[model samples]
Target: MPRVSGVVGHVVTFGRVLRQAGLEIGPNRIADGLSGLDQVDLTRQDDVYWTLRANFVTRREELEIFDRAFQAWFLRTPVSPFELSPPTPQSAVLRRIHAAGRPDSAAGTDESPAARGWSYEEILRTKDFGAMTSDEFDRVRALIADIAAERPRRRSRRLRRHHRGRELDLRRTIRESLGAGGDPVHRQYRLRARVPRKLVVLCDVSGSMEAYVRPLLLFVHAVRGSGKGVEAFAFGTRLTRLTRALETSDPDRALQDAARSVADWCGGTRIGASLKTYNDDWGRRALTRGAVVVIASDGWEREESGARLLEDQMARLARQAYTVVWVNPLKGHPAYEPLAAGMRAALPHVDRFLPGHNLASLERLGEVLMGIERRHAA
Candidate 1:
């Protein structure tokens, strides 16, 4: 990548590198690169940025990724005229090719396009968790893990807020940074209290939830893996503690153990009765100190019809949890409406109503969880 050769070839090489890096680039993207450089004037950085923004990026999420990749590839190269010869080595073209014969890994794992809410984000934001398979569900789990593992958006956020924007809480700032010397030479930063919160996941494993149960459990696992405690329960005719089952280090083993323990897996729904049991027994144990309680269910409510009890118990649980989110798989469908008796009853007790039918929708729970974190930290 010397700065003394063919310009077009270098741009082509960079584009190809990105394609190898996991972008869905094709002959068309390659062509766009050639024309893009001509119109944008590679001589100017902003011009080149806009050119790629228009020709290379099609989705909102890709912008962040494509930008970073562009910067790393182009800016890192010497400013002198680059050796623009075509990539000669076949091995170079083959670098980082995923099984799909294309680059699939994010350009920067840190600035993941996924975290920027890419195609998968739309899927989660738009679809249902119940309809999604275990693999798709894992992707959602990964997104949550990504967000949770990330320190903070701005470097300043990790440092003292005063540096970012907050007026120095002069007393604490000076006390923490100042030494015995008259002049302050070293400045120690205070860690800001973020929106720290806990999460509680209550999933329905009745016959009605078979399609969605595994995925939702995986979602819970992702949250828990990110160093957060999550209490999970799968209920049918009766309620069972999935907390211990999910505690195993391995996810697959945890799911299998949980499935084996829940007798009602794919059994009939006993909506009100289950909630009653939860309110009477598990709620306080799991919902301790105000956690975000997320209920994943289809809301069929076929067992003995005690909608009033369902509402009451959910209300009690809601009072203890910082926030209540009701995720209904049916909501994932395009035509789906909240017409189920159980859904209507639980709706009142919920802080947010969402679809949890597929990996796409369930991943959104991360954003919801992040919001709760912000609130708590504030």
Candidate 2:
């Protein structure tokens, strides 16, 4: 009975109020609440209440807080003010550690990094993984997981109802016309639904890429966890399927399992032979077809004839893949060039060449994967 736009605005404001009341509400959850509202009778207070509660609440402890806020907002009942707890010892310790990590904290300025024209996150973003200490890498891992949640999407042939779609929904239009004196007064439209595209990540686990492999594989694991259409492989002297090993929820455990699964964990590089194996096995089975293929390697080929073979396999891969992304960590260097034989050979077939050496670079790669349009997004 209420206007759709007005209801959406009200729900969004309600989400903000819940956030102010200490609930971890985000924009995605708010949007999901709006979608849930569409399926239920908004006029029913119980339906509206349950929908909002389901979308916003993550823990049982927050139920009381949510109920109080919902009562005040929807029922217009006066409630007692909620008291805030003092910072705990753990919070104080965390604050101290955060302060210690700040570059300008030594100056005794209380201003945040934003107020000081820089941020600690920005520093971590650009810092090379090889140079980062263990604690710093731990912080970087959380950021990587967040970044990897974004998967590239492609429009599906299947259609869903949309307000502004170009295609007409003939069946819906006909059904609604029966109630409009057979005049089709309320027409409906359908649009192709977008879904995550298949992703195949080949990470180099050889000795040359030892420093960067761990973080890159962590990114791949996060991506795999985000959706169903993901495949992961690790290569040193040979190719090894890592989709099962990286399926573990814990990143450290996943990495450990991946390392154990990989026999040539710190052996010589054989980019050409490994790729040839992938093509003969996976590519032949159409695993790379219409998939966004990411190759994370340092491009150091140990075999004498590896470069020429790498070029051939890369060309074969490029033809089958919708987009080919080559991530070379060494490219992060200021004076870096594609001087390695394998890198130079594969450059011709790469759709997007990126330096995935640091967190910032991985974030950039996520963006590219999300918005890739042309076949050659160089």
Candidate 3:
């Protein structure tokens, strides 16, 4: 293979090419494609094409676009460095592809602005979910899944044999010692195994939180996909369980299924009544017991007596849950405060209050979940 220092640039630009053709190619996919290329004979066109295709194309419908892009980018001859004609979008894209495919030694003296540390992916991490366009959101969904995969762990009651365990497995040790003339030269030990902790998400899907609901639900769906100990519920005027609906592998289809499952997709806000219902039905059934409870809402309450009821429900929930996480998108704003009646009421019971306005905030939420400790709140 040629000294392709620009392989990173090539993969990144090629991802943009696929995205331009309406395919959902995220940064992670680009990174995967680059890694796949590393394991293959780059000089072999078929190997290169299939490697890129396997990482970039997610659906049968995207095959045609992927093939066209691969052909145009990898097979086409380099364009002239200087062009006489006025630049257009297609021409601009071709030029970028050509630039990305160029060898490092053939490159110009000036370094690209991206080499200086600022990249579009960095900007996207901090960009608010509410402001993202459809294409941007599509690209970001994969990153969201990666972040959600970091689930909190709890020590299981059942013990597993471990070399570093503190408790000696005397029975096993004695059984093995019989074969060694009753000398206990080797010893076995047991330790409680760490397993994923139960995660319960209660997302607000009311009209007030319309801009953030989709991303929040996507986060919930990703968390649900991580392992078995996850439950998701959506609430606006009422509570609706969405764990099964979001189980579909396809994010788009999963979102659609979740929408259909929730009767109040984007209707009135009744934070208190919804919490009360959850407590009565699911919480009493021990769904919330020792679980990491996450509530993604703007804290808007429509009912007149919603604040008081919300406060009481939050208290009950905190008592049952191992940890309570309150995620408010508005909190991302500089001047924002917990001024909403529902927010104000729920704060006392929340173990960790976080902003869920962007990918960075969500990443922080994941980190918090992974290292979260039980709170002794009253």
Candidate 4:
């Protein structure tokens, strides 16, 4: 029967402890642990243990440290599995645990430590995705998934029952009037239905884009998981449909399956040919008719003739799609320009030219999609 605030504070304190002990714990993981706790019976030690374990433990080496930290903090008994000393002092740990459960006097003050930390996190969020190290990459993926989960929905032509709708439901009004002796007592109205817009992602997995392919696919998987109508395809020498592969709930498993399914992972680029194939085979049937198309590439095509074909395909896609967004990783560079032949060909047809080199840019893309939905709804 502990207060919810007390439990959340303890969880945050435990996260800090883990981070101090060389574990790559972040605020997102701590928040996830708190959410997991809400779903399980906290009275049961086993359930609580597993909930926190699932959220905090990612690698094998951290298990021992996490177990010791859990025992020391929750069970009120310290157990040392290794000869190495604790990273944090015992007195500091006790102070943090105790203070965390108490309300802060200057909670909303700008000079508070929490505010500073938030500012640092904001900077990290805006940093280039390609420039992030392994630890930053993992933390950013969680943020990306969260942003994608709040997917934007589009208004549909069909109407549904709504109390505040502008359109009157004449049939329902008359039917109800009959029951009320030809006098309408209750008014009925209908409003337009809403559905998620279809998002089609075409990512380049060619040799030049190998460094960015993994993160871009992860972003696609997040978009798909958000319940939006998403179709994902990776192109190198050919187009490979990855919607099914990325359907797996686990990001790692989805990436593994996607990798296994793709025949040419890091081969030469053929942007024109791939787009041509997609337009001929899938574009008209699946991609056209109000779908949002996102192409992630560096725009490096192998043959000079391919640039002409790319231009034609881009024009066709632009004509069909509601919006066509081009995400180029190199766009993060201050001196970068769309000088490549393929890029030049496709630029005119693109509706939004965005940088995809970082977590902030991806979040910005999410905002853009929401804006599109808002405009359409109006």
* Candidate 3 TM-score, true structure as reference: 0.68
Candidate 2 lDDT, 1-378, residue by residue in tens: 355798878888888888887788999999999888888998899999999999999988799999998898889999976643322323322333334345443455454445645477789899999898656676677789998887888898999999999799999999999988899898899999988989999999887887798789878988888789899999989999999888899777677667767777778899999999999999999999999999999899998899999999999999999999999999999999999999999999998899999999999998888887655562
Please, what is the TM-score per model? 0.54, 0.68, 0.68, 0.66
How do these models rank on TM-score, best leading? Answer: 3, 2, 4, 1
Model-by-model lDDT, in order? 0.64, 0.85, 0.82, 0.79
Please report how far candidate 4 places residue 4 from its true position, in Å.
Answer: 70
Off by over 4 Å in 3: 1-118, 376-378
In order of lDDT, best first, we have: 2, 3, 4, 1
Misplaced by over 4 Å in model 1 are 1-192, 285-288, 373-378
lDDT of 3 by residue, 1-378 (tens): 554888788888878877877788887888788889989997798998899988988878688777777777878844333222233323322232233233453244464434535577788789998898655565567688888877888888888999999789999999999999999889999999988889999999887777787778778878777789899999999998889878898766777667766767678889999999999989998999989999999998998899999999999999999999999999999899889988999999998899999999999998998887544431
On a 0 to 100 scale, what is the lDDT of residue 305 in model 2?
97
Question: Candidate 3: lDDT over CA atoms?
Answer: 0.82
lDDT of 4 at 264: 75
The sequence of per-residue lDDT tens digits that candidate 1 reaches over residues 234-353 is: 787788878878888766667766766666667778878887787677665565446767788888888445677787777787777667788888887789888887788888878888
- Give the Cα error of residue 90 in candidate 4, in Å: 46
Q: State the RMSD for candidate 4.
A: 16.8
